[model samples]
Target: MVSAPLPASALPQDSKDRLRLWIRLLRASRTIEAELRERLKQQFDTTLPRFDVLAALYRSPEGMLMSDLSRYLLVSNGNVTGIIDRLVSEGLVLRARRNGDRRTSIVRLTRAGSEQFRAMAAAHEGWIDELLGGVSGNDTQRLTAMLKSFRSNWEGRE
Candidate 1:
């Protein structure tokens, strides 16, 4: 029941163009995400959430608090809990009480998890490169800068 998106080319150089740009950006993001999700599942038998958790842990080798991990992934603690539980059961992640503080937990990737994530990360990088291959490096750099500025503009809003 969704209406077809208007063609960006048909939009004038005005507010309509802005709307079209936003729609195009969203569509591109979702398309890439869908493909990435499928590739992660079919190739590694894993989901994007699990891969994201591992990637976060892999970056912070010293480990992170469970709440911090959830925030880093932009997901609720409840959502992260189930993913962590499964990773722990699979021996891909380890959790420990922090310095006799039962209220706090530290989570990190296991050695196996690091190795596995590294492999997946490499492929992921290549996949992104392939998908974005159409864009020239200069254009990509400009687009990235524009997006970063756009994010900062909004994030700074009260």
Candidate 2:
């Protein structure tokens, strides 16, 4: 399907505003995520995926089933498996067979892993606060609320 050459701002005014907002949101999110990824690597010699796995385990105290972990992380089972294997080998996580289910395993952070994640969490919080320091608390709250509303609207569209 051939298409005509479009003008720079092909969208109408309101649409252009919404499109600009979306682009700004994407850019801001990417910038912050990139900085956090770099900081995680530099400060803990860890990747975001590893940190995220630990974070999930840390939250689940008793632990989560392997399948559940993958669902919660919104990643494929293979992705979670590799991270879990490494964490298990590093003594940062423990895995055990669930009763009557040899194929399924439960996983959780070990004490060391918990401590390490806590340290990283603290630093991560500070880094975010520093990055967004210029924004007022009220503005932050308003943006968060708006995003939440937007998400709910789309998510509930189903």
Candidate 3:
């Protein structure tokens, strides 16, 4: 036999409220992410991870090591490698081994890749604005600041 979980009433009021907030935040994030994923697929035939990779590379015009890219994205090297492989084949990115370090490679966006990402990024911004139209600019700023503080509070605990 298995034990039953505690009832919501058993939780302290503050705990319950925090739990509710977490759920609301998670649901909003998932809903927005799903919508963006669908829009990206329909509009650009791309995935969010691919867009993320491109965005990172675009920010670093020179290039980044594969390990650095993976760390920056908070993903594993293998995941970044697969995406880099695809991007390389598409001619959207170039990967060259670091000098004197054949095992490590630096990745950067090609001219065409930069152009394509710029278009996608502009559209992405519009989509986000449309989706989050209900939030006022002031509210967006407040919420962003609060979230940033929250993240800072919990940073590196994991």
Deviation of model 1 at 126, angstroms: 0.9
Tens digits of per-residue lDDT for model 1 on 12-130?
A: 77968788889999999999999999999999999999999999999999999999999889899999999999999999999999999999899999999999999999999999999
Residue-by-residue lDDT tens digits, candidate 3, 106-131 = 99999999999999999999999999
Better of 2 and 3 by TM-score: 3
Greater-TM-score candidate between 1 and 2? 2
Candidate that would win on TM-score: 3
lDDT of 1: 0.95
Which candidate should be chosen as best, given lDDT against the real structure?
Answer: 3
Candidate 2: 10-residue stretch with minimal lDDT: 4-13
Q: What are the clashing pairs of model 3? A: none
Local accuracy by lDDT, each model: 0.95, 0.95, 0.98
Q: What's the ranking of the predictions by lDDT, best on top? A: 3, 1, 2
* lDDT of residue 19 for candidate 3: 98
Runs in model 2 deviating more than 4 A are: 1-10, 156-158
